[model samples]
Target chain A: MAIIEIEGLAKSYRVYQKKEGLRASIRGLFRRQYRTVEAVRGIDLTVEQGEFVAFLGPNGAGKTTTLKLLSGVITPTAGEARVLGHLPWKRENAYRRRFALVMGQKNQLWWDLPAAESFRLHQQIYRIEPSRFERSRDELTSLLGVRHLLSQPVRELSLGERMKMELIAALLHSPDVLFLDEPTIGLDVIAQYNIQSFLRHYQELRKITILLTSHYMKDVAALCRRVVIIAAGRIIYNGSLSGIINRYGGQKVVSLQFIDGRIPADLARFGEVILEEPPRAKIRVDRRVVPEVLSGILAGYSVEDVSVEDPPLEAVIAEIFSRNGEPPEHQVGQIPELLKEE
Target chain B: MSEHPSYLRVLLTFARNSLVRDMTFRGNFLIDAFSSMSWVFMNLGFYVLIFEYTPMLGAGTGWGKYEFFVFLATTLIINSLVQTFFMTNADEFGELIRTGSLDFALLKPIDTQFLVSLNRIEWSSLGNFAVGLLLLAYALGKIDYSPGPAQLVLYPVYVLCGVAILYSLMIALAATSVWLGRNQTLYDFWFYITNFSRYPMEIYRGPFGTPLRRVFTFLIPVLIVVNVPARMLVRPLDPRAPEDFLLPIFAILATIGSLAASRWVFGRALLSYRSASS
Candidate 1:
């Protein structure tokens, strides 16, 4: 059975639309107007035990809302969701013991206490055995490399260091499922990598089900093979990472900065000019015309630096956002054309 | 394993943590301790001034000015003890709910009320308890009567009952966070309760005082905890129903209902908790 089973799960909040003014404020006390924000429209998904999944979406796309619903932090307006055969909204202590949610912007560690003290409180809360608690604490502290920072108050630690301590505090109970909303957000590249590698190693060793929502594409790309994309309170895309790329990302970008040539003046015939300066710059022709565009740009200018890479993820998502019915094609070069037309 | 932690364990842990957290700011602790001790002496001022114009409490009530001081002091004791522990950081729940911090608490495997209420420790209330005890001893010496072992036993019981009633009242007040939005004035509700409970109940004992008396007799139970304990220090124990213990006991029961209502309101509020953000 799936560790997490969400079927047509939906959530809506009666959000207040405040009218600003002294008179309006008093009037609002008697007659308040509220609009329902359908943050999570019906979303149906199932995660088999131990599946590492990425939940991807833009701001207000309901990724955090969905995670909140699954974690039982808030109520679902409609439908059903079950984790470990328990409704999250019921929020039983037993159910809570089996799961953990770590939000990057919010912290669980007590600011004025040492990280270890917070861990001890969590241990009591979870009723973890003393030996088991120590073992887990030592292992996580060492893994996150925050072992040395255990005695210092959480407020004294750097953001990166505090984040590591929070991880150890969160995982001490050894929950079956991990819910992370922007877990690696705002961390430096090295810190981000450290967190990512620890998550991967732990998941492989423990086979704990992991669900992550992050702005960093690399976190999803590096850790999750399956992706669930939400937009406008609905699941717009749910499939493999390759499926998202293949569906939205098309036309490889071939950017070359020629050392001594102006691309727009010299290489207009070769392909679309993306940027031109002391050297030339251009978006490559489609893959079918890769050889032609490459040879043409080389023939047309003195190219000193060049890089060929996939179109950026945000553009593909933009295309996804704007497109309806059929997914957009691999018209990667269409972006430069779309830009030129605009 | 026990369902909840043992009471001794809970007290020791809470007290230890309260001391440590307060000791970190040594200057603040000293200032707070000074203010709390001075409040007891200030409370006696009202008694001394009132009795200068009158000999006793009304006509038949023979309680002297020092005895009145004892009553006020004990009331303060009940209040500060309850406030010492029951005064929760959860009073900030409306903001926490708005900002998504409550989710961090909710996701933990613990009772949300217990966790939020006990998360922070305030040490200044201990000074109030100490000062109030000193005043009670001095007043007992000034008065003709002395409390026996039963009264000593009854003291802690009444205090516990008082603490329970106060906690329930505060929980009901704080639970309004869900519906009232961010600025739920828990202190306002507390002040209203304290106004009635702090005064001696005999001051308003009559047919017309039914609804008014019920405010402490049953409504919030502030009268039972403060009055019964102070009454113990004065006069011999009556044979049939001594020192109006029924009201305090009833207050404890009412508090149980209050806690249940709080949890229900809190659960409902969580449904609408937007997790406040900038």
Candidate 2:
């Protein structure tokens, strides 16, 4: 069943345009100027139950805005969205109880109190049964390996530990759907890995739907099977993670090893030369011409070994984000040249 | 599978958590308590000096020194309750909006107003509340009149109504923070408005004072907060004047109206809340 359904959802904000200097500031007191920023411009999306979907976009591309709309933190200016069969902006208690939102840059826990106090407060707010609350709390704490830090003040804990506690506070109610906005942002490599591992394991165990927005490709690659790329307030691409590579990743890198241990001079005709070592060489060619390029390289040179592989996911994602301002039609046609430039 | 928590239980939890938080920084808590109590004592001393010269607040006003002290106690009681429960929460509401912590609050499955209004209890302000009760008892003892059963029962009830009126005003001002982004003037606005409520409505008479009295009593309705309750305890309502008889009824209606208006304003403000970007 589809757990979330969003159609033509849009949100616009009126931002004041403040000019520099005291003169402008004085004039602003009498008449302030504002412009409408279309943060989320009419996008349609859906997610089935138990699907872990990655919501990827550059900064201010409406990734967080869409999450806010779905979570009912802010209302959309146009269109409709329903999460778990409830209109999110209506902010029904039932719907709010069934879902949770976690933002990496913001905290929900009491800063001066221990995480345990916050957990208890959540229990009261969610009205979880005593046994169920205890079970979920214990299970989540143990799973995240932060049981020892429960009694410590939240401010006293390290950033990673604090985030772990935040995750626990969010999950104590056993929400069926989760919205994560950059949950691993600002964490060290090990901390990020630990969080990713916990999320993957938890999602698998519970079979809950999750929509995660992240700037980190590792987070997207590690946890999400399906990817939803949003750019400039629109859903630019929505499909499987591998499908992104198939569509935008138009070129493949070909690494060749010469048997004679000599340099090849004419290898640039096949494709753009990426690495030109004496014994080995690597070049990037369009996927469609890979066979011809390989055959030509093999025919011309004394090649002992050769391999072809797709470009890195991070590079492909970066290319997509870099072209966020352009129309979709222009993006694909320009990718080859952009990749060559890279 | 969703069981909404009892509001009372949630309030208790919020109170308990706030107490724990306050206790975590015991020095800060003690300093806050001491400072609050000291302010109330200084105010009380100022009133004492004024009463030494004046036999009554005004000619034919019925607010003698003891009666005025009762009025001051009533103001203290109401203000202390509002401060202890709602003041800090209302003030922090703006900070929450500025920092985007309000997103977490909105995501909760409880009434936003209840959660936001009662989340943090300023236990330090309760010291003033204790002093207010003591002052009320001392003033009542000094007065030559004993209260009837109805006056005694209506006293606490009207005191609550006074607190509700002040809370409604404060919350409504705090809600404007959503649109204003940072409502640093909330405390100033509250102080200016409630300063009128601290004095008995009898002092507002003649051309200049009467207009101000009418505006605060009818429009803002702040004047009735302490006046109605304090009058019920100490000053006898004039049976000849129909207005005096209707004053208590007007106070009840004002409390309800203020609460409803504040709730509507808060709801409208929430609609305009642009959650600060993450």
lDDT against the true structure, per candidate, is 0.75, 0.90
User: Lowest-scoring 10 consecutive residues by lDDT in candidate 1 chain A?
Assistant: A333-342
With candidate 1 superimposed using the best TM-score fit, by how many Å does residue B170's alpha carbon deviate from the native?
A: 0.4
Which prediction has the highest TM-score against the true structure? 2
TM match of model 1 to true structure:
0.88
- Candidate 2 per-residue lDDT, tens place, A1-342, comes to 999999999999999999999999999999999999999999999899999999998899999999999988899999999899999989889899999999999999999889999999899999988899999999999988999988999999999999999999999988999999999999999999999999999999999999999989899999999999898999999899998888888899998999999868877888889887879888988899999998888788888898999898888888888878466777665544435424
TM-score for all predictions?
0.88, 0.97
Which candidate leads in DockQ? Answer: 2
Q: Write the per-residue lDDT of candidate 1 for residues B34-98, one digit (tens) a residue.
A: 88778766767767888899977866555567777778777878888777777756576556765
